[model samples]
Target: MLETPYVAVDVDVLDRNLAGMAAVARERGLGLRPHAKTHKCLEIARRQVEHGATGLTVATVSEAEVFAGGGFDDLFIAYPIWPSPGRAERLRALAGRVALRVGVDSAESAEALSAAVGPLDVLVEIDSGHHRSGVRPADAVRVAEAAERAGHRVRGIFTFPGHGYAPGQQHTAALDEAAALSAADLGDGVRSGGSTPTAPLAEGGALTEIRPGVYVFGDAQQVELGGCGWDDVALTVVATVVSRTGNRVIVDAGSKVLGADRLAWATGFGRLPEHPDARIVALSEHHATIEFPAEPPARGDVLRIAPNHVCATVNLADELVVVRGGAEADRWRVAARGANT
Candidate 1:
C-alpha cells in the first residue's frame, strides 16, 4: 500500500484514452503529435509513440532535451524560443541528436536561432484566438519568410486554440484555428492546431497535424467543460481526510501538488470523483477545504481528487503510481519534472 496524498494513474483508463485519441487522429488523417508537456514521463511518451504519435511536442528546450535523451527522436519545441547562450548550446546538441523543430514569430528570434542552432527546421506560429505567443495569421508568411532569410528551413505554420478551455468556446475556437491556418499562406506543410477541448472539432482544409497533450489524463477542468467524463479520468490525487467539521472536510492535497490554476468557470480548486457532490472549496500550501453535500466523511477517509489542471499537477509530481485492479501496479518517474528552462 502507498501513502496518502499521492498521484495515481489508472492504467486501464490511460490505455483507453490513448487508443481513443489515436483513432480520432487516424480517422481525420491528421498526424498525432501529442504534447509531452502533459505527462512528462518517458513511459507515457513511449506509449504515445507506440499508439501512433508521429512525434512529441514540448514547451521548452530542457523538456526537449529530457525526452530526446530518454530516446524520443522527433521533438517540436512549440514555444517561441529566444535562446540564451546555454539554451543555444543545448538546442544545437539536441539538433544533432534528434529531428528538432522550433517555433518562431519574429525575425530577431529567427536570426538568433539560426546563429545558435545553424539552419534548423522552423514553424511560424499563428495566433488562433488565444492571443498568446503567436503572430497574426496574415503575418505568418512574413515570419516564415524572415526565418527562411535567416537560413532556417520554414516547415509550416501552427496555432494553439487556448481559448477552447472555456465553456461553449471550443467550437468557436476550433473555427478560429481553422480560419487562421487557412489564412496563413505558408505553402504546403504541417498546419498544426489542437487542444484537448478543440481536438474533436479541429478541422480545416489546411490542418495536417494536432498537438493535444491533456487527453491522456483527464482532469477537473476537462470534466466541467464536457471534454471527458468522470469515468474517463485516468489520474487523480489520492488524499486522506485529516480533519472534519460539520459539512466540511479538510484533505491533505493542496496547491503544492494540485497546482494553483483555477479557471474562471471551474467550480472549485479541485473535485472528488468518489464524492461527485463535494467540491474542494479552497486550498492552502498543504491542505484542501472540501465542502460536502451532506455530513462530511470521518477523518482518515481517503478521497481521490481530480485537479483543475492535469499538466501542472503532473509537473508537480515526482512519480505516478500506476494502479491496476484498485492496487498499485508500478511507479513511473516524472522524468521531465523539473525540465523548465
Candidate 2:
C-alpha cells in the first residue's frame, strides 16, 4: 500500500461519533443538523442523514449549493449572509430545489433577503456570547419582527456559542444560549445553539436543535481542551518524514494540508500519531518541523498528524480515504472543499 501525504478518515470512529450525536439529538427531541463544513464529503453527509440527521448546516451559500446539487434536499446556511443581486438569484434558485433556511442578523439584511427570496424561512441569529454576526438577545425579537414585516417567516432563533470552545466556559455559554433564546420569545420554534465543545453540556430545554461540526473528526485542540479524547480523533494527515535530525524531524505536510489553527492554549501546530507527546513545532507551506520527545521518525516513515482544527484541515483536502480497522475501504471526495464563497 502506498503511503505518504494523504488525508485519512477512520470510518469506525467517525461512525461512532455520528451515531452518538444522533442519539443525543433523538434523546433530547431536538433536530440534528450536523454542520457540513466539517468533512464536506457527500458520503459522510449521506451517513449523517442515514443516522437520523434532520438536515445539513453549512457556513456558506456555495456549500449549500454543492450539497443541494449532490442530492441533499434539506440545508441551512447558518451564516448571516448578505446576498447580492446575483447571490440572491442563486439563493432563490436554491430554495426552489431544497428546503433552504438562512440566517439573518439585522433588519436591513432581512429585508434585503426577503426582497430577494420572498417569504423564506429565516432564523434570527442571537448573540449569546460569541459577539460574532448576530443581534443581541433583547434585539432578536426586533429583527424577527422586521423579517416578518418584510414577508419572511421567522422559524426561530439560532446562536453560535463559540466562546464555549475555551476551558470552563461551556457551562456559561450554554446558560447564555438558554437565557438569550428564552428572552427572544422564540416560542414553539427551533431555538438552535451548540458547538462541538459545548455539545455535551448543552441542555435540551430551549435549544430544539444542535449544530456541531468538529465532533465528527476530533482535532488536537479538542483533545487538549478535553472536549474529546485521542481515541475519538477520526481524521489524520498521513505524511512521510523527509528530513531527520537529533530531535527534530521534518514532515512533508504543513499549513497547506494540516492548516494553521494554533489556538493560544494549543501546545503545537499538530500532534503526531505514533508519539502523541511529540509537537509539530513549526509549519511552513509544505514542511512541518516536529520536535520529538522520544522515538524520532525515520526519513521514510509515514507520520499521521492530528490537526489543531479538523474543520479547516478538511477544507484543504480534495479527497479522503475512509479507513476501517487499519485498511482503506473507500474514498470520499470533498465536494465542497473550496466552496468559500
Relative to the unseen true structure, what is the Cα RMSD of model 2? 1.2
Instruction: Give the alpha-carbon lDDT of every model.
Output: 0.93, 0.89
lDDT of 2 by residue, 13-110 (tens): 99999998888888888889999999999999999999999999999999999999899999999989897988898899999999989999999999
Where does candidate 1 have its weakest 10-residue lDDT segment? 198-207
lDDT of 2: 0.89
TM-scores for every candidate against the unseen true structure: 0.99, 0.97
By summed lDDT, the worst window of 10 consecutive residues in model 2 runs over: 178-187
Residue 154, candidate 2: alpha-carbon lDDT: 92
Residue 112, model 1: Cα distance from true site in angstroms: 1.1
Model 1 CA deviation exceeding 4 Å by range: none
